[model samples]
Target: MRTCMTVRHGAERRTLMMTGAKLVLMRHGQSLGNEANLFTGWNDLDLSANGHEEARRAGRLMRHHGFLFDAAHSSMLKRTIHTLHHCLDELDQSWLPEYRSWRLNERHYGALQGLNKDDTIARYGREQVQQWRRSFDVTPPAVKPDSPHHPGNDPRYASIPRCDLPCAESLAMTMKRVLPYWQDMLLPALRQGQSLLVITHGTVMRALIGHLDGLSPEETQTLEIPTGTPLVYEIDKAGAVHRIGYLLPPT
Candidate 1:
């Protein structure tokens, strides 16, 4: 096995390369909700101005490192979609096939959507809010059917079966939906040696990374994926992870 480490500005970074196949997973840039410190959940919001620059920077870094993809994937949400667009445009590969799926959407925060995070922490107590945010299976309080934040009431999900629409979701539940898309869509492409780029939300990326890296539920909770950072995974022909790390130096 070969690995390279570099130090710049007092920070150490690791770069890993695979012999044949690669997978890149990136969390979308900061959203307006993120800027407001609100629980966005399934609410569709655009990226903030800083978020757009972040996406562009991520793209430039990837391109400078010669990262290329045969296809790209993102959630149906506008934030992720815009991030993908900006990244691809920066890479000058906007022609790549782009796949969008609801399975890649952020974890539904139920009635917590649109609420300020600090206020929620104050109202529900910090420990409970943390559990709702990080626990694998501890679902938050479900949004009422009439609640504006309820995904079941969103017209964008109209084509999906009503039973499949989530009013609230735990990380584990989000993984259940994400894995099928990986298995049905991404895995086969990888088997054929196609490099893939996936732009998604933080929790969704965590679910996928945990699944790919064989992490336990507890370990997944401790994992933090920063916005706009690209995680690179090198997989061998046997479908095992050969190496994994961030594509750019940590900011």
Candidate 2:
């Protein structure tokens, strides 16, 4: 089941058809746990059937908006890659080239990867879960070094420093991993007027947006950017601040 998406402030603003390319931050389709309300960080779960449909729907939504991504990027995770693939396919640009970087991945939840969000809420209490999910700092207890769940054994992360592997991350800590993409990859494209589409996790996106918008810790806590929504952005050459930030139709 897809969670209801909310595009809070875009409705009041008008979109510009400037010649410069902008970034489209897309949340990946509904995952199995997304329907069930679980924490999916770094678990590498496959997309559920309805999750695939959300990807298809996102593809249609992008095409309908008259936006074409020059190239795309996804997390190494399949949910994001598949979402991007599905969207590109619907755009009839499945053959278009793309890139993948771990910087765009969801915030790692360590030992919490396979846990149920609701049940965790029950055990930890709603406020604690909220803090874990929304709090900028305060990382949850990490997976033990010896646990099989530890990401150190994960082949995909073989190149990453073993010390950083299989650890927990707060939403604030997540930005440290995610922001580099903007610095190293995405920012240059925006400067060159190249349209880009990025499929990433919700908390990661929130961290990115939180950083960009200079959101307060309290404000970050209240912001509920939904999954599977299309966020269209326009930033200046320096990649400094949002010139025009809002969502598109069906927002």
Rate residue 162 of model 1 by lDDT: 78
Query: Candidate 1 clashing pairs?
Result: none
| lDDT (C-alpha) at residue 86 in model 1 | 94
- Which regions of candidate 2 fall more than 4 Å away from where they truly are? 1-15, 240-246
Q: After superposition, how far is residue 66 of candidate 1 from its true place, in Å?
A: 0.7
lDDT tens per residue, model 1, 191-214: 778888999998998898888888
Candidate 1, residue 224: how far the Cα is off, in Å: 0.8
Candidate 1 to truth, TM: 0.92
Which regions in candidate 1 have their CA more than 4 angstroms from the true location?
A: 1-12, 249-251
